[model samples]
Target: MSTFRSHVWSSVGKKMITGLTGLLLVGFVAVHLLGNLTLFIPDRGHAFNAYAYFLEHAVHGWLILAFEAGLLAVFGFHIVAAVTVAWTDKRRARPVGYALVRNAGGKSRKGLPSTSMIVTGLTLAVFVVLHVKMFKFADHPSVVYDGKEMKDLYAVVVAAFKQPLIAGAYVAVMGMLGFHLRHGFWSAFQSLGWNNDRAMGPLQNLARVVSVLFAAGFLALPLYILFFVDPSVSGGHR
Candidate 1:
């Protein structure tokens, strides 16, 4: 038991935890993006509202609460494990900075995405808190569709995106999310001992493709709301 506990706290073990949790979070993000895509449906938010209603009412909402609790725990664990690994790496580095800086080519996978992980991760952390507060906890006005009334979450989303400053910041943060995921997607594999010379290239390319799709997917929503979506639609006026 002691041996297991020690290994779990060790640098390698922490890194493994980070990798696993990161992949799990990535899965959640992808599903969430898919759900949010309903915002683009032309039915004046009916489709999006129905989606939101289903999630909330599924299994009488107990299942949703349990899943949220589990997700929160995973997020907490991922943050702690990642921060600990990064701190360990920093502490083990040479005290004095290197005199010369040179690119080590393919042998070194370091790049903007790799170096900026900490910054982007922390920034996204803040964004997540604000995002939840804005959309999840905020009071959403009710709307009726097909004789059923549900929270007009789609309206809240539209109203928020129509603001230039909010939309700009949202788009910028999504760009950072792309940079983070570009490295994180592949880095998770490397940390889990799944990467080798034969697989690294394809994994890296796949990571880049997924990152762009996610970032662009999210960025498109705010832009579409700002430019294409009329203010009178989706309760944006109220």
Candidate 2:
């Protein structure tokens, strides 16, 4: 039993952990995108402000803390597992492709994201840190609605997205995110033994569609905000 326990800490176990945590992250992204889509309400960002307020006030205390903590744990565990698996694969592989080869062919039949998962994943981690600090913790000016003070988070976000360079950077990151998700999604299923012969094609296609949607959906907000919406006039911090 002790030997079996030790063996379970090998390559397969690490990859299984990565797959499980990857699913958690996918779900988190979906929920975050749905919530953030409220920025398009065009009601001077009232809907989004109210939603944010609700999340902060009503959802405050230990419950929200626990949820946030759990998310961090999932992310930390996923990063550790993913890095471990990647390193282990690197150490065990022959030069001729007995293991991993992110860069092999010209067109890369494995696709760019699959080949660069570690890079993109780490890049996104940096993005997440900056993102949370900006929107989640940074002090910002406020807006008054019906005599009530709400964090001018909408304005803050708009201000950030309004920068051409910032907007471009965000869109580019979204592209990398799409690439990561494309490979991660199908690979998750494969790791879990769901990639049957008959299902592989459909699963891969579904992964592609989902990856594109996530990128497009997330990118749309910044594009729309920077181009179409006028935050100052739309009830943001004026």
Candidate 3:
């Protein structure tokens, strides 16, 4: 048990755990973006509301709660592992502790995304909490869909986006998400021992492409709602 515990806290073990959990989160982000795409359907939230309904009532809601629990666990694991790895790296770089240091490597892979990961990750953590609170738990006008009254999440989304401040903040965080994934997507593979000299370049490029797509996709809804769509009429309710 001591050996196992020591291995889990070791640098390599931390990287492996962080990488795996990061990939899982990447999957979640993709599926979530797909579901959010229903907002663009012109049926005035009918499609989106139905999507929301299915997710909520799936398996009598137990499945969703279970999934949320699992996701939370994964997130907690990823954060702790990543933070510890970063802290260890920082300390190892300057063992004398917080003293002025010069550049140590000309071949360093360090970049904005890699260096700022902790910052962006914690920021996104806060964003996630507020996002869930605003959309999932908050009360909003209800609309009947197929004779079943449901929360007009679409209305809430539209109203929220119409506010410039909220919309801008969302866009900014999504940009941060893009930056995080730009490094995370490929580095996760590298950490998992799947990278080679030949494959690394392509993987990095793919990560950038995916990051841009995700950032743009999320930005579209808010920008569209803020500028083009009328919140008063779009959600099929006031």
lDDT of 3 at 200: 69
lDDT of 2 at 210: 94
Residue 162, candidate 1: alpha-carbon lDDT? 89
Q: What is the TM-score of each candidate against the true structure?
A: 0.92, 0.88, 0.92
Off by over 4 Å in 2: 1-8, 94-109, 236-238
lDDT values, one for every candidate = 0.84, 0.81, 0.84
TM-score of 2: 0.88
What's the TM for model 1?
0.92
lDDT of 2 by residue, 1-238 (tens): 8877665466666676788899999999999899899998878878888777777776455666777899999999899988887877678653122112222222323668788999999999999999989888889778777878888778777888889899999999999999999999988876655555567679889999999999999999989989998756766444
Return the TM-score for candidate 3, rounded to 2 decimals.
0.92
- Give residue 84's error in model 2 in angstroms: 0.9
Candidates in order: C-alpha RMSD to true structure: 4.6, 4.1, 4.5
